[model samples]
Target: MPITGTTRVFLIAGDPVAQVRAPEIYNHLFERHGIDAVLVPVKVPPARLADFVRNAFGAENVGGMWVTIPHKAAMMALMDRCDPVAQLAGAVNAVRRADDGAIEGALFDGIGFVKGLDHFGIPLEGRRVLVIGAGGGGQAVAAALALRGVGELAIYNRSTDRAADLCARLAAASGGVTKVAASPDPAGYDLIVNCTSQGLKQDDPLPFDPKRVDAGAAVEDIIMTREPTPLLKACAELGISAHAGFEMLVQQIPEYLRFFGMPELARTLQDDTSEVRALLYPK
Candidate 1:
């Protein structure tokens, strides 16, 4: 299909839109599935986010926006309503205008992270997990991990207050099923996740000391990049299993389709994501 007036437009907004893999993934899906849609990246700084979103949505042909980086948490305030996860995480990765003209948002990062863990054959129930960073992605991953009935969930961030607040919200929502706390020590945790943007650039320190991570524990860096991040390199040197964020984004594809009003496409993807995975982690 050619880019024409009928092509529904989706914009991904971020300060640095160059690192995003959504357009490559979603556009491939649309083209392969014969859907007349296009996803493009748009760089919108923090100050102009509200204006950009409002004017972009005003266009009738604009389908939705994929929130990224600094925009996720801030986008929540612009939404008329958000799903429960978004409310809990105070962030959203996908947003769209409803038929009633109300702006709606949803967070898929947590579910996608958990599903990605399943894909990696990592156990969640009754296991100790440490999530570094209390930003939008961190909050979403922690919230989803709590729902998985983890034995203990520890949040580590530069700001103790932010991590403490996230723990409080999870406690209320999970009814204390999962023990949540604020800690920076990575020792003894079965699973450790790096949800910060630290690994995105050179000279950025690893979120946690890989040497301190317990034996048999797995580490995951949620920064999407084609190359191995410093954290992953450190993990490999220590002989520990470490994975990138590609799988997490891959798992979110179906959820994104469903959120964008393509239930059938979502179902088809849920049934078999092998092709998508292969595309992300090709030989």
Candidate 2:
């Protein structure tokens, strides 16, 4: 089929857009499926976010955008209405312009993390999970895990108030059944999630002492790098089941594509996971 003006356009906006690998991942998938859609990263400073997004919707070719970093929380006010998840998470990572010209926002971080675990056949139901960090990613993880019927959730952050606030929000959304606690003990949980940016730099310390992590717990870090993060490395050294951030990234791409009204593109991209891996993790 010949492509026409119907070509779909997607944008990912963030302060440090240059470090994002979304363009490489989505572009590879688009080519593989012969879709005319293209995904690009846009460097939008904090001050320009509102204007940039408002103007973006004016372009008929623009399907949607992927929000990131410092913009996630700030972008919520710009949307017409937020999805329940985004509302609860207090952030928006994906946005779609509705037929009525209304912009709808959603936060996919939690769903993506949960899906990644599902992809590995890891069950969170009835599992004791500990999440470190109470920021955007942390809140998302808590919400996602609660939805999976986690037995208990322990959230620990530098600021106890923020942790408590997120716990209260998630508990309300989970029908108050999701037990939220505050603890830094790693031995008490079945799963550990690191949502902080600590691992992005080489000098950052592990979120928690390796000695405290339960040997039976499954560890997950939302940081992608050639070498395992200190936390992941410690988990590996202790013989614990662990995963890197790349898995979560791959798991979320399909959901993002679907949000843009291109399920066919999502499926096509999902079908070419091997090629994506090659591009993202070239030998």
How close is every model to the real structure, measured as TM-score? 0.86, 0.91
The local lDDT score (0 to 100) that residue 233 gets in candidate 1 is 91
Per-residue lDDT of candidate 1, residues 130-161 (tens digit):
88988877999998887887878888888888
Q: Cα RMSDs of all predictions?
A: 2.7, 2.3
Model 2 clash pairs?
Answer: none
Q: For model 2, how does the per-residue alpha-carbon lDDT over 1-283 read when each residue is reduced to its tens digit? A: 2335787889999998878878877777677677788888999999999999989999988999999888999999889998887888888999989999999998888888998898778888778888888888888878777677787877888888888888888886665654444566678888888888888877898887667877667888977777888878777777888898787677677788888887876776576666656777888
Which whole-number lDDT from 0 to 100 does residue 227 have in model 2? 85
Candidate 1: clashing residue pairs, number: 0
Superposition TM-score, candidate 2 onto the true structure? 0.91
Once fitted onto the true fold, the runs of candidate 2 whose alpha carbons sit more than 4 angstroms away are 1-5, 177-181
Question: Candidate 1 has which clashing residue pairs, if any?
Answer: none
Per model, state how many residue pairs clash: 0, 0
lDDT of each: 0.87, 0.82
Residue-level lDDT for 270 in candidate 2: 74
